[model samples]
Target: MGQQQDDEDREFDIKWADGAEHKEPSARARMLAARWKENPPGPVPFRGEPEGVGPRWSSWVSTAVVLGSVVAVIVLLGYVNFRAPY
Candidate 1:
């Protein structure tokens, strides 16, 4: 029984050596390559805003807030400079 088990284990053992000959791609690989050749994949579709969907109102509100802050800073600076006693 032990000798039989040893033989079975030896059957599965793979022997590796340098300069091994290269093998052709398997059947599944060849089939996939042919399919790809027939209908080559294109660039991944752009996942931009969905159709019929417009920009969110929050985006507009944020833009307005940023612009308003910039204008307010400019106006405050002008007022302060004009009031400075030179």
Candidate 2:
């Protein structure tokens, strides 16, 4: 069992690269590739304000209003159901 575990953990020596000659890219390919020379693709810079930076009192007030409305509707529904004659 120990020998099997050792074999499983051992990395196999695999030859991935084929002996192929490197070819030069075409003129159009080089022209398209030149765009990245100025601005290389990478993580975007943090320009704007951090998340939730400003005062969030308005958001909290709106959330409380919505929740209170929902609770009031639920209570009204329960009261109506309780008063219904079967």
Candidate 3:
């Protein structure tokens, strides 16, 4: 089991050419970056202060949806009548 585990943990060998050269960015990539610098996209806000009770309103909506679902289920079960036959 130890030998099998060692073999599983072993990494495969890779051979790289000695004459390989790193290529610079193309003209199109440079142009796009320059244009973005001139006029960037709008910022995306992940977390910020709610505007005029916005956060509280959304929380109330979520709570209402959950409670409404529970009440609906209870009403549905009340309408269901089951009988046992022997």
Candidate 4:
């Protein structure tokens, strides 16, 4: 049996050499970290739940509202400036 080396082991300062020097993690630490590399804690875990509309839908709705308001204002302004023939 032999210890495996991990590739994604990031740089980290750990006590070493009688606590005199601080530098990158040793091969042992890197190897240990690699074991959990596949499942690191960071990204939001998907809690079992039915998915629904996300941020994309929210942005689209807001944009549509703003565009509608602008168009309405422009039409009202033009109507006021040029009234229908009496």
Candidate 5:
């Protein structure tokens, strides 16, 4: 039925907004850049993809190291409150 087809099309639009199957580059771009850019907008969401805003072994690791060091310092300070013998 016509109503059912329209519903399906609407559903597809919603899925695309949710980062589902993506669209190919346009013809106008081919004349200009001659390249089909991959996921130019943002991180393409695929199932089972772990948390990442960059490529492998990058800033995330460095940030984690710094945070770990900070926590360690806090824990160590609690063990010994600095109070000089008077």
Candidate 6:
């Protein structure tokens, strides 16, 4: 097990070379800022609930709630129509 862990660690090890200068993002940053000044971004897009990242019970609860509301609406409408005397 220790050997396997060592192999995994080796696989993720980073080897940085000498004398590598990190480039700045000033150019792209200025360009995006200018574009935003001209045409600002609209409302944030709605990314629906992320998959597989919440309580399993919460999903089942929401689904049951929605179905229960639909059934309740149908039953209420039927009761109302039956009592309408039309």
Task: Compose the digit string of candidate 2's lDDT tens values, residues 3-55.
Answer: 98776555331222223357578898787689778767777777855787985
Query: Model 3, residue 8: displacement in angstroms?
Result: 33
**Candidate 1 residue-wise lDDT, 34-71, digit = tens:** 99999988777678678899877798899999999999
lDDT of each: 0.83, 0.76, 0.71, 0.69, 0.75, 0.80
lDDT for predicted candidate 3 compared with the true structure: 0.71
- What is the per-residue lDDT of model 5 for residues 1-86, given as tens digits with 9 covering 90 to 100? 99999999999988877785666667887655644364345456676556675556779899999999999999788766665344
TM-score, model 6 to reference? 0.35
Superposed model 2: Cα runs more than 4 Å off: 1-57
Ranking by lDDT: 1, 6, 2, 5, 3, 4
- How do the residues 1-86 of candidate 3 rate in per-residue lDDT, one tens digit apiece? 99877765552211223234765578998898899999986786888677785545678899999999999998787666333333
Compared with the true structure, the alpha-carbon lDDT of candidate 6 equals 0.80
Sliding window of 10 residues with minimal summed lDDT for model 5: 34-43
- Model 5 bad stretches (over 4 Å): 1-57, 82-86
User: How many backbone overlaps does candidate 2 show?
Assistant: 0
Deviation of model 4 at 77, angstroms: 0.2
Per-residue lDDT, model 2, residue 21, is 58
lDDT of 5: 0.75
Error of 2 at 86 (Å): 1.0
Model 4 reaches what TM-score against the true structure?
0.36
Backbone clashes in model 1, listed as residue pairs? none
Error of 5 at 64 (Å): 0.4
Q: What is the C-alpha RMSD of each candidate to the true structure, in Å?
A: 7.6, 12.9, 13.2, 14.4, 12.7, 13.8
Better of 3 and 6 by lDDT: 6
TM-score (all chains, Cα) for each model: 0.36, 0.35, 0.35, 0.36, 0.29, 0.35
